[model samples]
Structure formats: C-alpha cells, structure tokens
Target: MDPGLLYDLSMNDYLNFLCVSGYNQTLLKAFSGAHYRCPDIINIMDFNYPTMTIPKLYGSVSLTRRVKNVGSPGTYRASLRVSAGLSISVKPNVLKFDKIGEEKSYKLTVEVTSPGDDEAFGGITWSDGKHYVRSPIVVGGVRGVFHVLDKTQFIDLGKLHQQLNLEVRRKRRSKALSQIAFVGVLCQGGTVDCMK
Candidate 1:
C-alpha cells in the first residue's frame, strides 16, 4: 500500500492487483482501451453439450460460422471434420463468406455404426489463405443395449423380506424381465418376453 510501490508496478501488475482486490468492473474498463481492440478473423460455435444420447443410424446438429473480419473482401472457405468411429457428412461443407460479419450455418449429420456407448469429437477449420482457426465439436451417442439400475443398496433385502408383499416382489421381477427383454432385442435382434 506504499505510494512508492505503485511507481515500480507495471501495467499488468496494476491490473492483477485490481483484479485480486475484487475491482473486476474497474479492471475490465481499464483493459477495454482502444489499443486493446484487435480484428477477429473468424468465429465458430463451441459444442458444450455435456451428454447427448442418440439412437443408432442418424443424428444431426446445426453448426454456425461467422466471419468477424473479411480482410480483403473476397471469398473465404471453411470445412468440417469429424473424429474416427463416426461417419459424418456436412451439408455445404464448404462455406463462402463475401463480406465481414457474414454468417452461415451448416447441417452436420453423424451416422453411428458401433453399438457401444461412445463420444465423438472433432473441429471445423476456416482459413483465408493467410490465417486460420479451428473450433471444437463434440457429439455423444448410445447405441445397442442400455441399462438403468435401481438404488437397491439402500433397501436391505434381508430386512425387506419380513415386510415385503407378494405384489411388490412381482412388480420388481416384472421390471427386471422387461429390461432383460429389451437387452435381448437389441443384442440378438429378436423380440423376447420373459412373462410368456
């Protein structure tokens, strides 16, 4: 807090001190100077879906791209790419931007082949023959058999047996049979019924 200490502090040090002192508003205003402004060449959407469960075959999502600065005012191109284990096709994979602030959207179709639950990740890259940037893309899907287990740990079966009724036990057995039938259908490609 000494007055002489301020003279030795650099611009970054001053901003860091302001930020650590909880003067976030004042820190942002100080950093938003004209000299801090720079041209943004390209901007793309970031995929942040924590978990997306999709069925087999096809799942689609729309991706958006925008040209923040069209330097020479010519054609700029962008393309989409996906990770392995997933077949992806982008409608209008190649995008053209004529001017700055021009935005375009593309449809991304993903074909899930494997039956196991998995996640896919990739990115889209845009370039103007001089500068380029890649934005991340993520997709998650579940195929084949899926299971949902109950929290039976809290219910002590030994203690429940004394108070359990036939109806309650039958209902639990019926639920288990239905799950088994679903798994059989997915794995063997045939309908199964434990009740029958």
Candidate 2:
C-alpha cells in the first residue's frame, strides 16, 4: 500500500470512530404517553345490558443521537417498557345491568380508572329495533319485542334461534313447526353468576 494513502485511510477511520463516541456527540431524549382509545363492546340482550367503555394509554420514550461526520448522520428511536405505570387500566372490566330490556329504555354506566378521574352518567339506552339480525324493520309505531335468550349470558346463540323460531311461526301460522333442536336452559351458574 502507498504510505500517503494508508496514512489518510487510518486518519479517516480514527476520525470517524472519535466522532461517533465523542463526549460532544449530541443526544435528545423525550418521554411521552401516547393517546389510546378503548375497544367497543356490544352484545345481544333479551333486554339491553348496561355497558361501559374503558379508555387506555400507551407510554413510550424516544431517543435521538447526532454524529458530526457519520455517512448517514445519526438516528432516532422510541420504545416502551411493559410495566404498571406504562399502561392504563380500567375499573370493573364488565359493566353491570341495572335494568335492561327491549320493552323499556335502559341506562348504561361506565367507570374509568387511570391517571384521570372516574365519571358516571345515566340515560344511555340501547334498542334491538335499530339493529335487526334479519329483515328490514319498518320505522315508527311498530313496537319491537324483547325475547329472553339466556338468564345468565343475557345473549346466546340458543336465544337467537328462539327469536328466529318465533319469527318463523309468526310468518307461517298454519305451517307445521320445522324440525328444530330444542335447547333447554342450564342450571350451571344461576344466581351464583352475579357474585363475580
């Protein structure tokens, strides 16, 4: 190798290394909590079931490094550690129903827990009429029916089948009942389910 060219190459490598590891290298750091929204919860109910929305937040830290003579300059990166303070939590993960039915308007309550305060409001109503599982429902005057599907789950496949069964009977009054599998209510939880 040529002496002059080798000296120049070594000098370049040394300068590059010094530039990256020097105490004067600039670094910027920031810690932030990114805004996050809660997931939506919807379920079928013989009557409307009281529901709640829980909000969440994701916290992260960002860092940037600056180098004077690097080929591609410096870079920036951000990360979040999984910890109690890093994530926001909601109270009462499941909302309780005070009074819910398709017959009458029901109220839903929401409780928030995190860095902020808790709030409670009344008069939140849900209607099965608005969302029909099948067929376009006519607006106004036609009262919607609230059929109980499950006493524990409030909404279940068996209950939906029952509602459809009733609709079929209403449509075909004189027709013989179809060969539908009958589903009986199970005594698994009963009142003990509410203690959870």
Q: Pick by TM-score: which candidate is best?
A: 1
Which residue runs does candidate 2 get wrong by more than 4 Å?
1-154, 173-183, 190-196
lDDT of every model, 2 decimals = 0.42, 0.26
User: How do the residues 128-160 of candidate 2 rate in per-residue lDDT, one tens digit apiece?
Assistant: 222211111111111112233344454455566
lDDT of 1 by residue, 134-170 (tens): 5555655434334332334212332344344454566
TM-scores, in order shown? 0.40, 0.15
How many clashing pairs per prediction, in order?
Answer: 0, 2
Cα error of candidate 1 at position 88, Å:
1.8
lDDT score of residue 162 within candidate 1: 35
Give the 10-residue window scoring lowest on summed lDDT in candidate 2. 132-141
Q: Candidate 2, residue 47: CA error in Å?
A: 39
